[model samples]
Target: MRVFIGYVSLSGNTEKMAVNIKNRMMAVGCEVYMERLDTVEVDTLKDFDLSFIGLYTWDQEELPYEANEFYEELVQADPQGVKVALFGAGDWSQPRPCGAIDIVSNKMKSCGFAVYDRVLKIDQEAPAPDRIRQCEDFADRALSWGSKRKKWRFFIWNRMQNNPKYQRTAYLLRRALDDYPIK
Candidate 1:
């Protein structure tokens, strides 16, 4: 699988999680590409089979400046069947812990991308063994979802292109089926 990981980090917490995710994905024989969100080109998203986004929640549940900028660019682009998985690091005590994950996930869904259901959120300034394991698990789930999505890609894209009603219907169905209790 070809995977793209774009992230923004303040104080290195999110960056650490991004790196761990990159390493874990690479270990599993994926062709992985990693870059800061500020430096990534939104148009290149279509080239990847799977994409991972990492971000830190800013004050009051907002995405950091760079992530917000990327989100704006992302909103204007067609999803083109790229599946996205979100991960982040934040303090659990914060008023909105890892809120950026929700922001990005919602935006990706709105843009008609197949978003992975399980998001990886770490409550630490640095990764612990448990958190590292969580990253690996998240990568595994993402790969699994990507593989399954391949079988339906042509059908979904065809419906999305030829029928406007099917676009929303397909998204809603996928969202319902992918929804699961997060551990």
Candidate 2:
């Protein structure tokens, strides 16, 4: 599957988690595009079949400026057919841990993306083995979801045309999805 991973990290914690997720995805043989929020072209999100969004929660659970900007662009974009997954790093000791996950997840849902079931959180640093295992499980689930005929119905097929990188099987599935009904 084609996957996009975008994240913002001030302390390097979020970036670390993002990398872990990317590596795990790669290990599973999924094609992945990873970028930092400061450098990523938000419009590119529409091109991927699945996306993993990561960020760090700032003081009072607010978004860092770069993350806030990306979040706004993501909200404005037409991401209806993409499957999304969220991960974040924050002070778990705080009353609320990784609030950015909730914020970003809600925004993505508002834009009509199908969010993955799990939202990963790190207390203050990169993932340990347990956390890495969580991401692996998420990767497995995402791969399975990407392959399902029912999940493809959400994609906007016209947008997928002309992409040579799309595998033949994926292309055919998208074509089929275009004709499939929502309900």
Candidate 3:
């Protein structure tokens, strides 16, 4: 199965997580493709079985603008059966929850994607060796979960507009896709 990992990094922490994910997956003999969220184009997706998104939260639980923007684009692109997992950089010093994984999980669930798991990382400065290994293990698990086929989205529009939480999020997402000015 083919897998792709996408990430957005500001202080390079998220990028490191992506690299570790790629390397670990490669070691396991899986075909992997990875790109930064900034370079990833929304139009040409659907080439893989699983897609992973990495980002950090900025304010509250909202995803970064770049990653969030890509997610919005995915909403209007016609649904596909892809398993997605989220990983992101966080810090032990902060009170904010893992920004990248949390937002990705919520958004993907809202949009009807089969989500496997969420990985959250604290900033590494003078790090413990076990922590690094844990990160690598998380990557391995993510790839394994990504290999599975997601639950099919039949009657996708009905599911999107009828689900309680998704109903509201999808409306706003539709507006974003159509360039409706946010009020």
Candidate 4:
């Protein structure tokens, strides 16, 4: 059961949570690979059974510049049969958890990853005690779930190649996503 946590942090709040989550998952018996947002490449996820995404929400729930690049590459690869979780650290703006969760959750869902239940919400106040406990429980559940899920055991076959015209477009889009570095 290999799990990875990919995250982008500025003030270090989201990074702190990623570290804590990795510790918690390790305590619960899972091998966790954590990477800062910039260092991880898209191919790193080829074999991970479960992945967690962390971001620093800015101007609402949007990921900051660097994190956006990481996410774009990930979606470009179109991770097949991988379970994914999305989370972030942001202020208590108008909608709680809506900002990061909304954009990421939808995209991941569209990509066919199994979206898990625990949507963690935290702020400088660190959320309420119950919410913290909820997140802890979520970590335990996710780790256990990840440990048992079966790997796809084969390469992903993108059907888009069946049509040359569409394939060319998709190929160009993927290249664009890769070459476009995050500012």
TM-score of decoy 3: 0.69
Steric clashes per prediction: 0, 0, 0, 0
Candidate 3 lDDT over residue span 118-141, tens digit each: 555556452546545766788777
**Residue pairs with clashing backbones, model 4:** none
Give me the runs in candidate 1 sitting further than 4 Å from their true place: 125-127, 148-183
Question: Model 4, range 7-107, lDDT digits (tens) per residue?
Answer: 88888777767877787777644578999868887667667878887776777556687867666765677566677776667787556553766677777
Model 3 ranges with Cα > 4 A deviation: 42-45, 124-128, 148-183
> Which regions of candidate 2 fall more than 4 Å away from where they truly are?
125-127, 150-183
- lDDT of each model, Cα atoms only? 0.82, 0.76, 0.68, 0.68
Pick out the ten consecutive residues of candidate 2 with the lowest summed lDDT.
Answer: 153-162
TM-score of every candidate: 0.78, 0.75, 0.69, 0.70
> TM-score for model 1?
0.78
Across residues 43-82, which tens digit of lDDT does each residue of candidate 2 receive? Answer: 7777887888888898887888887677777757777677
Which window of 10 residues has the lowest lDDT sum in candidate 1? 150-159
